[model samples]
Target: MMEIVSSTVEIVIGLLVLIGALFSAFSAFGLLRLPDVYLRAHAATKSTTLGVLCVLSGAFFFFWYFDNYISARLLLGILFVFITAPIAGHLNGRAAYRTDVPLWEQSVQDELEPLLKGKKMKYEEKDMME
Candidate 1:
């Protein structure tokens, strides 16, 4: 019975690790092959977030099940991720947009365009002087 439980847990952990690995690898590939910064940012944010979540969940499972620790780190990690990941991704995308990185032709209604018009150089100069 112990053997069966251990084997099952191992299988589940291995599957999570494999999926995480695949997502991370795809993010790397997209970063290399994607034509533009915005698209690359999209891939990097989505895939890497998912990959990290999978890896974290696997860690949580391993610790909770194998070590029998009552510290629910997984729930904490999930909450942290849920709150921060989208914020970070949004910041990254916003940075890309502010830098005037061209979006794909299919992109609709770039609201940032007017916000940045005639102001990027001033900001750039201030940043450089700092």
Candidate 2:
């Protein structure tokens, strides 16, 4: 019975790892094929984050069941990736926008333009006053 349970867990872990690898591959493809920085950032952060999480989770489970151990480093890595990936992506997109990177022609909307425009006007006013 224990052996059967272990085998089942192993199968699930394999599936998780496989799915994570596929997601990471798709993320790489998106980075290569996407037209603009923003879209690439979205793909890089969202899919890769999920992929890393899934792979880490599978590793976590494998250690827990097979070795009777819980790895703090793995847990911390999962938490870190979950927290930072989206923020990094957002910052990358923002940097590109501030530096005047061109958006794709088919982009439907730019939600940041008006908000940033007001900030830009304020900065320009301050500069002129100085």
Candidate 3:
């Protein structure tokens, strides 16, 4: 019974690892194929983060079960990735926009465009003051 349970656990861990790898590969493909900075960043961050989370989870389970050692570090890594990935992606997209990176031709609506256009540059404001 114990052996059967152990084998099942191992199989589950293997599946998690396999799924994580597939997500990672898909993320890479997205990065290569996506036309613009924003979409590429989105793909890389979202999918890659999920991949890393799954891989870390599998590692956590494997180490805890087989090595008789619970790894706090792996759990912490998963937490860090989950927390930062979206924020980082957002910052990257904002930076790209501020630098005037063009959006893809098929992009339907840019909510930022109008808002950015309405804002005055500091130089323009200074000239207006004078």
Clashes of each: 0, 0, 0
Poorest lDDT segment (10 consecutive residues) of candidate 2: 107-116
| Most TM-score-accurate candidate | 2
Residue-level lDDT tens digits of model 3 in 12-32 = 999999999999999999999
RMSD, each candidate, Å?
5.4, 1.1, 1.8
Q: What is the lDDT of residue 49 in candidate 3?
A: 93
Top candidate (lDDT): 2
Candidate 1 has a TM-score of: 0.72
Better lDDT candidate (1, 2): 2
lDDT of model number 3? 0.93
Summarize candidate 1's per-residue lDDT along 1-130 as a digit string, tens digits.
9999999998999899789889989989999998777878778888988887888878878878899885567878877886787788789888877666778887777776777765877788899999
Residue pairs of candidate 1 with colliding backbone atoms: none
lDDT of each: 0.83, 0.96, 0.93
Model 1 residue 118 CA deviation (Å) reads 14
Residue-level lDDT of model 2, residues 51-112, one tens digit each, is 99999999999999999999999999999999999999999998999999999999999998
